[model samples]
Target: MTRTATSAHPLDVALELEPVGDGTVTGRTTAAYANMVGPFGGITAATMLSAALRHPERLGDPVSLTVNFAGPVADGPFTIDARPTRTNNSTQHWTIEMTQDGVVATTATAVFALRRDSWTSTEVAPPAAPGAESVEPTPGPEFIRWMSNYDMRFVDGGLTDIDGERGDSTTTLWIRDNPARALDFPGLTAMCDSFYPRVFLRRGQMCPAGTVSLTIYFHVDADTLSEQGDDAVLATARAQHFGRSYFDQSAELWGRGGALLATSHQVMYFKV
Candidate 1:
């Protein structure tokens, strides 16, 4: 169902898109999701996926996606072109580009597949954390507007005083929409990018940093997501290596009953 910007939550409004024909959709950036430089990266990625999910020929649920932030997105209107480049008996591939004023700002690719009931097993373990109720919610920094949209209670590696607190770069938290919306693919996609950049924890100070590329794989279907209702999802992330200009982060989201929802990895670049 298409969410009407007029009556839905701010997230729905930020994600709302208008059909402009030929697989293109136009949307505006709202302050609700604004970042220091532009709209938050997670919402940008979610919007791209939403376009393909709404496509007339979209085959099934999104199984995988890769979003590349090519340039900064200014605060205003943007256009996204989501094209299903290929489709098979059970899978479809899509290419999406978000442009502002005819200039490419972000690009993405998505894969959707018809899932079947088959033998499955989870090799990774869920994030070990006390119940969400046991942990105290951390207040988002006032300057970062987008952080206010999520209710986050940290188990460890929470956003710390940037600078001189060099320690482990792993973050475990329970997070959900501030207004408690049902968990879905778009929300799940956005959540995958919700972890603050690991570099901040490593150096103990914020810098000019941003995600360059993010890739996510969804492990559950619609029924499983619906079961989550508006409950917070357990999330954990850790960095592998930090180089001169970039670092790698791997993360996972777990639903109730210790069910894994998705796994994601991102490459972030930073400058001193």
Candidate 2:
């Protein structure tokens, strides 16, 4: 029997939230978006940010966000509580948490700022990797449900090797929603977390690994986002250091025409 695809984009379905009053919102994890251990970390992060975006008192747009995965989030329903800790004339700060079974599973803080015309420049260069059409799409593992939702064309560093032969932890790929959805903050937020853990690329084998914390800085404004529409973005991620049970990965997402859209960093937990 053929499986029927979900009509709503996985990101959209995962981010669907219901307000429960007092700055609280609730959502559930969809099986179509599951990771090895739980829901993909990126979706969860976006869900947390969604609470803040949906908050009645929110101001402006997301400038920077930090999410801490305090514990594993089980499948089923979860709750997010967001509060504006402070608000200023041009900026706003918020604190958010996700809870499952009455236990805090994730916590996050975000800063939103109103943009104004100012001196703008980017010193970071765009990816020198081959164009997306020149490379083959990276095949995702069958166990990772979320991979099916994206079309990932890799220039280098994919899940191809798993026997400690690849020698480095760097991945460059072009990614976008599989069914082609327009770019938005929540969608961009989830894409930042889409890259597989660097450990899988370096070790050439799945060693228990997961992101413990993730942070992203948005560089583009709403107008820029609308211009992106459904086009693929180039993303490159590499590990800064790996020691003991933790390591750090940094990534940059570039939109069409080579405009830098966002930068992300994460600390991951791995078992030896």
Candidate 3:
């Protein structure tokens, strides 16, 4: 069965890619998913990943993904060209480029590998923050349409106090899709970049900031995502360093019972 954008989740609708053959796809940005400066970076990343996922040559599931935002993606039509650069017995590598008006706007690389039963362990401890029900829903910025897509309960480190009162760049929150869509790899990938840019939490004011590059390592497979359903997941994000022009953010997403789903890192460009 073929899936169309209108029949899919809003996120999927926003990232809907039409196969154009020859390892290329076409997509469009929706106003409903627009962010402060442009479309949310997360959605763009997911869209780029979708190109590879939908490709006829794709193998296995995504294990790692890295997206680089080279320029602003204009709303409306865009094109993604994905090619399998390498293919191993149990893994595949892809390079994707997104362009608008014939100019490159984003590029990404992905590694897909088949999962195997093996020894596993989680070393990082989950934060002892209050449960999602204990915290009130945090209001999202009205100008950012994509903000309304998620229900967020902040346990700590939110954008509410952008005046440096908090003094640190740590944000812990519980988040789930607003319409309660089932959890999946594409959704998880979007969530990994969903944390508000660290600048707001650190400086207490909005500044010109955008993600330059983002990387996510998936820890769970398809079965794990299906088990998560539509439940809220705990997300913790913090900045390691904020320099004059750029900063780095590290984050983790954990499912119920402290199962780590993904780990993400990104470098952001900020202007005073």
Candidate 4:
């Protein structure tokens, strides 16, 4: 079946949650984004963020978010709680949790703030590359269903080998929703986690892997976000350290005209 069969975009469907009363909501896992062991971590992260976004008490846009995966989220229904831990004149803090069968599965914290005009500058330069159109789009591995949801045109460090050569785990790509949905905060949050595990690119092989914790810092204010439409964003990621069991991944997402949208950091578990 096509992703639009339900009329709602696949992402909206993936992030869908139902009101269960008392300021909580319930959601279910979708086959569209199923991973090897559970649902895609990005979708889960976005869902938890959605909890905060959907709350009526929410203030301003998101500035930062951190999701901790405590356990695998089995395919089924799960509950989420978004509580405003603290709120100030210009900022708000939140604590969110996801649970299945009354057992905690995921936990997250987020901060939202009303942005004001101020001096702005980007200390880092964007990577030099041709526009996204000039590059050829690569098909996602069929095994990972969620990858197909994106139109990914990689500039370098693609998943073209499994046992080839070991090298730096850096990937630069232009990406957007496959069907071209309009850009939004939750959508941007989802895209931040869309890259392949850095370990795969560095080791030139696939291993049992998953994100342990994912964090995103949004540099976008309301004006900047409104300027971003459906255009593909330039994204780049690399691994800073690979230890015996875990590796660290850092990434940046840039909108058109070198607009630094967000920067993210994540840790992943790996076993050779």
Q: What lDDT would candidate 1 get against the real structure?
A: 0.90
Pairs with backbone N, CA or C atoms under 3 Å apart (clashes), candidate 3:
162-204, 163-204
**Which candidate gets the maximum lDDT versus the true structure?**
1
Scored against the true structure, residue 152 in model 4 reaches a CA lDDT of 93
**Best first by lDDT, ranked:** 1, 4, 3, 2
> lDDT tens string, model 1, 1-272?
12224457778888889999999999989898888889899999999999998887789899999999999989999999999999999999999999998899999999999999999899989867899988888978887898898999999888754567666898999999876778899999999999998888878888889999999999988787889888889999999988889999999999988999999999999886
Q: Residue by residue across 1-272, what tens digits does model 3's lDDT show?
A: 11233456788689778888899999899887898767999899989888998899999899999999999988889999999999999999999999998899999999999889999999998887888878898879798899798889988887676665456888899998877788888889889999988888877888888999999999988887789988899999999998889999999999978899999999999986
TM-score of 4: 0.95
Better of 1 and 2 by TM-score: 1
In candidate 4, what are the lDDT values of residues 172-239, reduced to their tens digit?
99998877777788889889999889888877788888898999999997668868878889999999
- Candidate 1 accuracy as TM-score: 0.96
Off by over 4 Å in 3: 1-7
lDDT: the better of candidates 2 and 3: 3
The C-alpha RMSD in Å for every predicted model, in order, reads 2.8, 2.9, 3.1, 2.3
Candidate 4 residue 13 Cα shift, in angstroms, is 0.9
Clashing residue pairs in candidate 2 (N, C-alpha, C atoms within 3 angstroms): 162-204, 162-205, 163-204
1-272, model 2: which lDDT tens digit per residue? 12345687677888999999999998999998898878988889989888998889988889999999999999999989999999999999999989999999999999998888889888999768887777778768889888888889987776665566566788888998877788888889999999877988787778788889999999987787889988888999999888989999999999988889999999999986
